[model samples]
Target: MAAGGERAKPAVQSRMENFRKVRTSEEESPLPFSDLPPDVVEMKVKEGSKIRNLMNYAMAQMELKGRRQIVFSGCGRAVTKTITCVEIMKRKLGGLHQVTKVRYKTLLEVWENQDPLPGGPAQNLTVHKNVPSICILLSRDPLDPNETGYQPPEPAAGLQAQPGEAAEDVSGSSSKGLKRPLPPPSEELLTKKLQVQGAGDPRGTGASDHQPDHHQ
Candidate 1:
């Protein structure tokens, strides 16, 4: 038992050391956008577009906040891709401190319904099944409302109608050669005219009636 316990100690210690090294490396060296895979970059671009749309939708609210907090929810590749995008955006914009504040929530702990257990496994969980991933960005500055509500200036009274151009009686014949086309007859009027024409056709009815007496 003593030998077995001693054998396990070194293995555990080695794992702890490796964990520390990984954590330190992650803190010291963040993954750059250029380091991201092509597929990841493509995904980021797609997700970034959605973030832009959301920012546009709540422009006023984002402006009021004075800082942007991005939340990326997804599993594995999705989370990593968005994180790359966020990091790139931060670096391109001159770091997080340049703005009032910048933050992110990607871990399951942040999105879980119940409080996370202490030292719980930190992993990215998928949300919004169809979407697979989502990203949002807030802005410090207020977006311009760009209100164009000004009423158009009313036309000058002189422009309304010149004294020489008095309203013409359109119903009467005009001096101008242009003639307005007359409206077409309605279905009811056309049907009545056809009936009247049929009644006036005496040969159609008279010839047929006179011939019928021969058969009798």
Candidate 2:
């Protein structure tokens, strides 16, 4: 029993030492956050983050708060996802200036052999890799210059005609080149000649009053 215990103690101690070394390396591996613009809103994306959640945050800042610029940043596998979010936002909002930056991030990886052959010491390997990273900048004017610019569906653009405008158009068309029929004449104001000509009255023919000429 004593011999078996002695053999197991060194392996356990070696694993603990390997764990400590790995923790120290990983702690020192990550690079500091890059400098970003103060005026723009910066969003950091990760693999576990959902697109919908990120979009909501972006909309609140850009559309609701009227932010002029926005930036999307991601590294490693998240780089593609970050690009996708930016594209979707651009299509929805429209009229934005876009700029992209590519960078690399270095990650330190640690590999250890916990169980080694008898009489062989445990080993740890540290590898450094550079991962791809991306940053996208989108900017737009605070005011909308184009009437045809895309608008989000959530808030209405007021496409329907206004009451005042409709009234004015109606009045304008009625006043231009539009002739109205005169109102019917009153019985008391009607003239004899006018009444006679109105509907072929017998008095209008005047032949009834013609007298026969005398024989010469």
Candidate 3:
């Protein structure tokens, strides 16, 4: 009886598989493009033509917008989406379009070179041939006024300071102006201090002494 039931299950599975394949084939059938009305096709073509014309007009306006720097302010997601859309558009239309991907560091560098002052206008910008398809200016949320006018901290004065040594100022400052390095205590002195501390305390010096009695 078991052998018979196993054979019947295979037959049932094969039938179900055939039904699924038929259903999938019907669903995958191409749409009746030829059966569409002549008027409907003409209308769709006209609509597409109108849309293309509108896009061209908008692009022309953008190109003619002059050499003013554009500041886009939004949340991270919106800003990213805007940058992606701009990049795609630039890729479609090639020309003197300049799209620079500016990160926080690169943006600062650009600003430092062009205008060091806060919220100052960038100057003498020339579009090079190697400019990216998208100019992504990563910025904080525009809605949050607190983030505006904030500057990144300056780098440390000394780049090659040792672990125990005081770093000299590279900004033409006197060596005497640098902080004095404190001398490390001798190993023997440290050991003696530890021994004295352990003797005074009832608990032992090691970490195990500080551990709670697990038996309790």
The best candidate by lDDT is 2
Q: How close is candidate 2 to the true structure, as a TM-score?
A: 0.44
Q: Candidate 1, residues 82-146: lDDT per residue as tens digits?
A: 55544555434332321111223232211321333368864333332222333333222232223
**What is the Cα root-mean-square deviation between model 3 and the actual structure?**
26.8
Q: Across residues 1-216, which tens digit of lDDT does each residue of candidate 2 receive?
A: 999999999977876664433421212222222333456677888877999999999989998998877888887888999989998998788767666667786667777766656898867777777888777777774323232322323222343346667889999978863744543567436655665665486554443434333221
lDDT of 1: 0.38
Query: Model 1 TM-score?
Result: 0.19
- C-alpha TM-score for every candidate: 0.19, 0.44, 0.18
Per-candidate clash tally? 0, 0, 1
The digit string of per-residue lDDT tens for model 3 on 16-59 reads 34321111001112212222223221111111134345345435
* Model 2: lDDT of residue 57: 96
Q: Over 4 Å off in model 3, which ranges?
A: 1-58, 63-73, 97-216
Candidate with the greatest TM-score versus the true structure: 2
Model 3 pairs in collision: 100-135
Better of 1 and 2 by lDDT: 2
lDDT score, candidate 2: 0.68
RMSD of 2: 20.0
